[model samples]
Target: MPSLVTPVLPSGRLNASAQPALPIDGDLLLRPWLASDAAAVARVFEDPTIQHWHLRKADSEDEARAWIEQWRRGWESETACHWAVADVGDDRVLGRVSLQSIIMVGGQAEISYWTTPESRGKGVCSRAVARVARWALEEVGFHRLELGHSTANVASCRIAEKTGFALEGIRRRALLHTDGWHDMYLHARLHEV
Candidate 1:
């Protein structure tokens, strides 16, 4: 039996011999970031609503380009996969769903995502997340996918609920915001595939 007081480890660590592969779904192909995506990424970050839901640097076109470069590097290094959620039939970038800060601790991977103003309430991000979650579980071999969000982000909470992530609990004052430290809701979805 386990004690309820024992805390779970963050998913950034894993023991030897428990290798988990990251998944790539060409069917849900991510187009390479373009120079044009700079403007789009900038627009996404301009949405104060979106920023309130994420932790990001001060916004600028140059920063957006730099962000894309880092995104490319992550892919090249096999560190993580980031998919630009676009208009589905066009090159216009709407937002992004990314496997950010992947921590393989204790046989799990912590996942995170975001969406732009134009794409909100349209289900683009949720569908993208579901596709990625399926791939992460069935293809990546990660035993768990962890999602964390501030309690104030109702939209993201909805996304987690819609995607079948169970609300585990809260990490009190886990993030530093513009005003002060904020509470974070920890959500988890064990590999069901």
Candidate 2:
């Protein structure tokens, strides 16, 4: 059996490099969320599609600031890593990509993402997910990465496949959204040994 290796930080959290900026396709960048991005974050969440799937609305800039802080805490605690997907020239927020439910000992984590209305259909989420997955597997030493989304979300399904995650299976009534229980399709990619 192959032995597992976990990255550990001095602070007792999983070692995620301090440099959070991940470049994608020259025009896009994925970096750690900042407090100043509260307004843009709130704007992205204002999309009805984002609100429906995420189940909570960040209707105000304050709420968005709190959301950013929560993810920042997640990093300190090593529970998650969230990044702002931004345009390189203007530094405008285009979306977000995250590695949530990180378990270093288990060599696993789950991926999630959302894009602003303007960014949809542009492959922003797909490229961001692919970059994050590579970083998680190569630099962070995670062996398996999982992504699950409502089966009704065809865009998310496409992003999963585009990023090299294979369809694993579906979990009936796996997630509860505002509308009702949603059947979720789970996808995954394993590190190449």
Candidate 3:
């Protein structure tokens, strides 16, 4: 079937090249997940805050390694982009920031993230998110980037606002967690060209 409108971004636009490591600052950067970081990944999921908000866990090193592999494949599929926000000096994993639910035709993607307990309240997640948003909208040619969080996740709401993702509206009971359904706050940032 022929469509009137063309794809907003060309096929292979992302997978055509190696995924780039985006720099956040002198101390931090966004890099591909490594197999060696499995322990850190597993430990991060053990944090009560992370498990509660993310609603998933890597109970063992093997599970975390599998997740890392899956994230690598996601870059090839172009369906998702996941990065480990790490310290530049020691290369320690601090958190994760991702572009999920990507749609190439309309040039849109959803952003999601979680910071390690030790890194929380240090502005790490927000800064990493802001950097990723710039790369998505400016460097990658995405027209729109969205960040959605459960209404109860107030810290996530702050990250969205700090990254220039405007509060669009609330998605009633959009996400299910252990507690129950949650109303999600939808926020978006548009390419400024």
Q: Locate the minimum summed-lDDT window of 10 residues in model 3.
A: 2-11
For each candidate in turn, the TM-score is 0.78, 0.91, 0.98
In the range 66-85, model 1's lDDT, one tens digit per residue, is: 88888766555445556676
Highest TM-score, which number? Answer: 3
Model 1 clash pairs? Answer: 11-103, 11-105, 12-103, 12-104, 12-105, 13-104, 13-105, 13-106
Best by lDDT: 3
Worst 10 residues of 2 by lDDT: 6-15
Which lDDT tens digits does candidate 3 get at residues 1-193?
8768888877899999999999977889999889998999999899888878887888799999999999999999999999999999999999999998999999999999998899999999999999999899998899999889999998998898888999999999999998899999999999998
Worst 10 residues of 1 by lDDT: 14-23
Model 2 spans with C-alpha error above 4 angstroms: 1-19
Q: Say what the RMSD of model 1 is.
A: 6.5
What does the lDDT read for residue 121 in candidate 3? 95
Could you tell me the TM-score of candidate 1?
0.78
> Which scores better on TM-score, 1 or 2?
2
lDDT for model 3, please: 0.92
Better of 1 and 3 by TM-score: 3
* TM-score leaderboard ranking: 3, 2, 1
